[model samples]
Target chain A: MSTTEPKRRGRRPNGADTKEALLTAAREVFAEQGYDAATVRAIASSAGVDPAMVNHWFGGKEGLFTAAVQIPINPAEIVREVLEGPREQIGERIIRRFVTVWDGVGGGQFAALIRSVAGNEQAVTMLREFVQNVLFNRLVKVLGVDHPEMRVALCGSQLIGLGMARYVVRIDPLASADADAVAATIGPNLQHYLTGDLQLLA
Target chain B: MSTTEPKRRGRRPNGADTKEALLTAAREVFAEQGYDAATVRAIASSAGVDPAMVNHWFGGKEGLFTAAVQIPINPAEIVREVLEGPREQIGERIIRRFVTVWDGVGGGQFAALIRSVAGNEQAVTMLREFVQNVLFNRLVKVLGVDHPEMRVALCGSQLIGLGMARYVVRIDPLASADADAVAATIGPNLQHYLTGDLQLLA
Candidate 1:
């Protein structure tokens, strides 16, 4: 060690350094043991920091995962943008927004999430939570529809399906089709899921 | 070698025996080397039979894969059943049939196919061909709709997405929902994709 450098022992590292350390540790632990088996205490210990640091920096495990996974876009902003339009066009707006965002980021995060979901319990949980909490719940509340849970799930199925075919699976025509074309084709389906009759039992 | 059985080297094996051997060898080779790298010659050698046997039995690599994978149900039959019903209710029938088939098989084949699709090129190709040829093409031909390709793709996305969510990823509610409930919820969306306006070129 350089003599000029400050002593590291017993001194609290800067917040940025601690946070980075925690993220690195979390990624490693999650990869190794998966989400269910990974513990906050273990992650903190691996980072050479106190367990409380995790709660302090991120509210809890879900918050920590949100940080570590780093889903490229803020879902809240997307939701807000979609809701700004006429309620009838909400489905079209949502589909367009989805295509634009995924295409904008080159679908790296979504691809990674989908690929990891098959074998990883943590990934599956993260996906379910993200869809239910971030995307579906908010829309369901805005729509104020009956069977909100089923509405959200149906919507999720369509959007997630679009993502899978166009991005992950790279199915032809859909994969290469322009965003407008895709939106136009898929928008109505999303509309039906969002506000149309699901034919569910009341 | 069984003492009662004649020496096996020079004789061309029986058709059933040779076909079975080729299928077993093809499965191992495909799993180990993936579809792109697994050659017919390699499979034949592994089966201890002449390379010509693959062509004689299954036509080629694609046919061999179809035999090995064995997707539990026939696509043609499902298409026929869906088509036999009234044109307006085709979507509901299709969704019901889909839920019934996947639920009947216990989702093993669907889960396996979805999971394998990510890393395996051969699996992706096979999936594309299966969807495009067996499912989509037949449906499009029956519907004789405008933008048949897009229609097929949109339908594929929803079904594939539902499978991923319910079986592969096991998202709650949708995953646990009975076949009837799932069909009721997702049926209309599928119907829309099948015969409803897609808003293409607008």
Candidate 2:
């Protein structure tokens, strides 16, 4: 019984350790070589693990990236919260939510992501996926607006720009302004992107 | 008399050559070490000119940078164009102007500026000053809106964000979308930031 118990414990811990090693290796590889240049084999080799382990654990490079740079907040939950609110105030609520999460909880991860984005194609891809696939796609679907992609892109640009100014570039007034104040000033524009007329070409 | 004239010509050409040398050296240094890490002395030495020449021609490193990365388009001219139109269409015109400048004429310089901004504080400072002092302050004054700074900042965020996505990050749809389409979609939001009612707190 004792021997069996030890073996069971060893199996689980080994899996956890391999996952951790892959994550650490992946971050270093991504930082050094960037997203496009980083390969699964290299990440695995750096971790001293078999290349297949990456697929087994992360499914692929994109999944591995998502795990590596995961924000603390869940996109689905934010989508639900924004969608649950009064439809008219959805824009205000969404901007306020972004300011809160990005300022406090997700600030560090976001900064790291934004910093990596300048010269790194992978970082840019990761950012695009998170904004497009994770956040805006779901929101746009819920809104059922015309030219949903364009609408989402516009909203994404504004929010990402707000993040860039406030955090990355540290533009003044905008950077130091109170969160609610920013939301109030910027929220209407977001709302316009969401439910307002986009006037996209056919 | 011939000897005296030759010496005079020699002195003027030397001065112009030194100034030109400093400008070339400054661009290389700024690109390699970024704006903050680069020094006037280093730029001068790289150019094989006396360090004081940097101050003589450019006034300082900041002036040198302004000269190096100067955007071809005049912000004041764009502001005039946007404001001179029918008040209702101001947003559309402004966004159209931004898309045109960034996509074509000023694309390369803007890309360099935005790319450097990630790790370079000096680039950020330059961008902030250009947006605040040169562009938005004048536009806000023309509009005479309340919370003028905030309004300008908001406008700056959106425009900067569009530039980042389309040029730097290269996000699709927004990146590839026609300028007129983008302007139509994003224009109203700018209009809102400019002349629309902003629900700012007291």
Candidate 3:
């Protein structure tokens, strides 16, 4: 009884497949209902798994969410690349690299995620976590700039804004415009955010 | 028979009040269901009037939407203010003035309106019209930059990003932070967007 019950209690029938199913289900649920309103039961139902499995695999809803939408980007990787080049060209590289990621993702996922923030509470929180923990934290470590954290936050605002125009709201001409053109236009401002002497009164 | 039906064709029974009620209902319905999903009949019902009243007053759904969320600002008035000041300081003034409007509105109406774009096709189209026709068109005149239209669009990206951070997502210290503080922090970047050296390469 002890052995059989313990085995049944902890193990998922199809462990890896269950986890994948949960993630897929979580993405759909999170995207649809947003972070706050989405429930574990709904996600479990969507995945056809036991609610206990969610806790066993991912701790809880937040952990499951982290696993679902958390992009595995190492900011150090980005910083390393940006800093490896000449310091003066950092802005161009930074902007170009950012445009590359959004462009590479085909704009739909990122755009959906960004546009979803306005209506859903959980989406907004998850979005902040993704930006703060995944993106901004990484940028601060790599740049080695003075006031790097503030600089990273500021730079993030620029990129987020660019995404809104280019993808979410799809402001024409700019929305449909070429990637290189955006990089060239916005790169410098982001660079300034990272290293410029932006005095408060100035 | 003609006299019996005459009142139906005459000026709306209680024209001004009916118009105001329609505008109020339109904003809520448009905010909730968006432009396409929101029916003239529904708006009329919400306003306790006839559907024909919408067509009579605003010409159609587009006009009704225009009247609903439209923030009445004279571009000429704003542009004249910018042109009067030192051209270089135009960016800062514009940023400050823009913030004042958002603050005056207290973010609820605009935030709800902005948030409603999700999962709705009609709302998206209406948002595009509002931004391009109403918001950006006005900003372009005031920018007075080398490429006035392009600069205005870029500035719009910057401003919207600030709004997302400050109001929508309410990110960090910026969210709870004072209006003056935000203006001081982000105004210059916007200022630069308006009048900075476009040649500065990243």
CA shift at B167, candidate 1, in angstroms? 0.8
Interface RMSD of each: 1.4, 1.5, 2.6
Tell me the lDDT of model 2 at B69.
Answer: 69
TM-score of predicted structure 2: 0.77
- Sort the candidates on DockQ, descending order: 2, 1, 3
Q: What fraction of the native interface does candidate 3 get right in terms of contacts?
A: 0.34
lDDT of 2 by residue, B68-135 (tens): 76545587688888888699888889888888876764354555666566656677788788888888
Candidate 1: residue B136 lDDT (0-100): 77
**Which predicted model would earn the best TM-score?**
2
Candidate 3 residue lDDT tens string, A1-202: 2323324555655897898899889878877765667799999999999988899889999788777765434455676787777776677777777667767657655555664576666667776766666666666666566755556556666777777767777676567656666666777777777678755442
Docking tier of model 1: it is acceptable
Better of 2 and 3 by TM-score: 2
Error of 1 at B150 (Å): 0.6
Model 1 agreement with the true structure over A1-202: per-residue lDDT tens digits: 3326534565565977998999878766755554555799999999999999999888887677667665455677877888996888888888888888778767745665565665456677777787888777987797798778777777778888898888877777898888888877888788877888877744
Q: Model 1: DockQ against the native?
A: 0.48
Query: Which predicted model would earn the best lDDT?
Result: 2
- Clashing pairs in model 3, backbone N/Cα/C closer than 3 A: A35-A122, A35-A123, A36-A122
TM-score of each: 0.74, 0.77, 0.77
Residue range with the least summed lDDT across 10 consecutive positions in model 2 chain B? B1-10
Evaluation by lDDT, superior candidate among 1 and 3: 1
